[model samples]
Target: MILLLLTVVPVAAFTPWARNDSAAYVFRDHVTGVLEKRRRKLDALRRKGGDAIIRDAVGRGLHWNALGVAFPRDARDDAFEKFAQTVVAHQPVDRAMLRHDTLAGRRLTAADHDAMRSERRRLATVDADQIGATGDDARNSRRRLAAHDAGRLDATGAAIIDDWGLSFENVTRISLKAHAALGREARKQNLTAGVVEATLLPGDVAAWLASPRLRAALDAYLGAKAYVRTRIGALRLTNRLTAPYSGAEPNLLGYPSGFWHHDRCGRRVKAFLFLHDVKADGRPTLIAEASHRTHYYEYKDLLQSRFSDEYISSNYDVVQLVGPRGGGFLFDTNTIHKGRSDGKRGRTVIIADFMDTRKLYTFKKLRYRGPCGQHRTVKMGGEDIACQSWCRR
Candidate 1:
């Protein structure tokens, strides 16, 4: 572990400035901090039967934390899960609803929400519904079906709608709840990222998950109810470069977050809500408009490293999601995007991901489910999410 830590932590210095650093001392400090954080996480993941889950995860080269192993879930989670499964959409949303919702009193926006237009597929088309990536499962989505989902954009209903200008009585309350709950995570570890779920979510945020807007959008987009796929969504924090390395990287020690890449999450739309003001320097996410529809799951060979920003910009309209606190956008992460978080500043962003419950739930029952130490495991990005149809290993 020490050798591995030494190799990765110091190498980051060559990439970009993360907070401040005096290579003479900060390197060792970063090593200590990172190891300590991993030890803490390992302790938590190894608790109860969590080790079994960890073994299952590591054996498959997966991230153990996202399994949500051993994390306590109460009655509220059960209720929310049920709500997610039952809610029906009055009307289906369009291919890409680029609108912002309210969070922390801020509104998010996707400049051209309708830009993700495709004649062959709808925003909700699952991987199985279309051609799949290579070396995937046997099907690999070889059969291409023309989504056949024709719709007149429903002003009220959208496949990907966020809570930007739309304010409910609980928006502020939910924001505060998220801060209080997620802030502790940030302060405790100067966290880089975490998958928020279950008890980690405050009451208001959990209730908001069941809100008409989220539910309707999810239901319409999926053409069925959404389900909780272990990771409820992202409850990630990015600390300013003041620390040794930008922040605690407990999730994926060196997950490439800066490059413009697709989330590899297929046929999915995630709602992002910024906890504080996010700007170009604060690691705000920069997205390529219309790429969501244009790229359409061709994520295997995507990223700014290979496909330069200049090239992508030439083909697609790049939209930087810079907004104040509470500002965020519900984007089809399948599009090209990047978060610029080199520690110039830091911010906390929570993402609410609504996955297709119909296919997800149908496959697995209570068979392999359990607390952390003994939870079910899948490859990273989850093989179950839209059939693991995206481009990462």
Candidate 2:
């Protein structure tokens, strides 16, 4: 009886989504068939003696399929046998003719029989309904998943819609959430310490740099080594700008000449010039402060001091600029900044940087002097002269 209760109750509960699906239905049917066959065997045992019944039941249960198949065979043989044994052993029956007598008592009451029949019928109905519903759901899910895989939905859009369908509220909520997440990541990358840096709206400065005349000028200045290209819908020029002299290979460090730097003497030196006007006012040239002093020998000490890998030392002051679209300059390797052409319309400018190759001439007897000329000397055939013109005190 207990074994029957376990088998019937679970099968009834599984009639909905579980039995409706193809895989689940196959498993369910196989298990149910096996249980019914066992039930008949148990009933026959009850007609015989109790000891005979136990022996017969155990023999039948032990001969279960051993191929270890899933669903029908595995589920029934393994699960049902153990369950039946536990139930049969607990029955209050003596060894003599108990099986036959108990079998008579085991017949279900009218209400119980009717209830079981009704439950079985209800399960069949639910399983049929679920089969149709699940098929439709799977088809729709596949279509949507394919569309997403084909790039019809971008990374941000796909993530949002996949979890929540095409609802306006969901889209908007997801977009805002994505923007917030990106902003957080940017802050980490930028190592921003204070207030958030404002980002210009998309296409805000497009008109300013999109003119044919400006493009022509930039092309002429930049030459064939580089050109402008639209990437991710943004108009940007790619070129190797000259960089400060690091006593290394020329192309290895492309320095931006349109920059400024504070020399060891704290004197502001203009490093390069830009050919284009950035629309944004006070748009600064970006600079990363090396934790070490400019001298190469101090680099190891700087690294030891826990200086940030990339530190922002200074930037151009754009506060005085009239508007977002305006010509601006960046100091040399000392300070870092980039041109912003998105601030206004019809604003155009050129960009260029100076390459420092003084290291190549360092061994030519031209003594290295301080920032200002103090003591001067001529080389080779030239006469000795005061270095006042080169070195500063």
Candidate 3:
């Protein structure tokens, strides 16, 4: 069972401007473009080995250190050279083609085409580096790509290019490593074999939090600060409780915030609590089985069959916790879980999201790259999707 702590922070509680406005649109557009480019390249390679041609041509003339030589003192140029090398190692032929010239006329064998496609698929699905690339790099990349595409190559453009160069380098490294991590986790979990959906409820949380008598545990755990109430559409806790120290926010998925996909790296709500009792007949939450992996589209049919809506609707899963006032349930976030609304008493529970901050920082240090874009800041149904995205399986 996956535990997700829903922090029902009223929209009005936080500063109005604290919400990110530019992120969703920009990210949507950028990611779309990146995917498109990858698709086109793969298509070209499949059709005429044109991708190979381009890579060969680019590899031949690009000069291993040309970017560095062109901008000798530019740290960005140096970073780009390093990045290019790394990219080459994974897709040596592509890197070679990108630098080579005479390879333009070279013909690829069927095996070669298959290999290229495999590499393309690998790159397309790779997760962003959790640590590589800084926020600045992402910003710079966006700035440069915008300027270059707009035909503006002034000093500002140069700076943007530098930033973009660094960003590309960072994202490439981070994404590659993250992909590797995902593969390892998948194998460890035997996910390749498949998993079945598990039913979890707020009563579970309450049972865990309750004592031998199964009464409210608020007085024991939360003391006097704990107060239960129904507001908006769900039950919630209003007081603050002490939490273990997690490191500076996680930057999983190469985004500034650590909330783009589960398994990327960061502290996430591992368990959820249901405040009300199950016999109360509350709304049911929906959890998608086998939805934890990146292949979200694969689960579309399953979601449509199960829910009134399709497309997984939003990245965030609404969960209902039903239990006694002080009882709660706990579970991991790695599982696909959601709360459903049967229009009954919205289950109420004290929610707690936890992450191993130390592990998060360690992952960051292992994969840290320069920044390239702003952290994700999109909201859906008054909840932060960025964090949910990170928790996405």
Predicted structure with the largest TM-score when compared to the true one? 1
Native-to-model Cα distance after best TM-score fit, residue 256 in candidate 2, in Å = 12
Better of 2 and 3 by TM-score: 3
* Candidate 1 ranges with C-alpha deviation above 4 Å: 1-169, 186-199, 202-204, 224-230, 233-255, 277-281, 294-307, 342-345, 358-393
Mark the regions of model 2 whose C-alpha exceeds 4 Å error after superposition: 1-276, 280-284, 288-293, 296-327, 336-358, 363-393
Candidate 1 lDDT over 21-95, as tens digits, reads: 112121334333533444454455445444454344334332211001111112123322222122111111111
Q: Which of 1 and 3 is ahead in TM-score?
A: 1
Model 2 local distance difference test score = 0.27
How much does candidate 3 score in TM-score? Answer: 0.27
C-alpha lDDT of all candidate models, in order:
0.37, 0.27, 0.28
Best by lDDT: 1
Q: Could you tell me the lDDT of residue 317 within candidate 2?
A: 24
Give the clash count for model 3: 67
Q: Write the residue-wise lDDT of candidate 3 on 108-213 in tens digits.
A: 4566447434433332232124335454553343333433422321111101111112234433443343345445555676652211112222232332322211
Residue 61 error, candidate 3, Å: 40
RMSD of 2: 36.5
Candidate 2 structure quality by residue, lDDT tens digits, 26-144: 12344345345445554554555433433443444322111111112122343333433432322221111112111211234566446434533443344345355454453444334
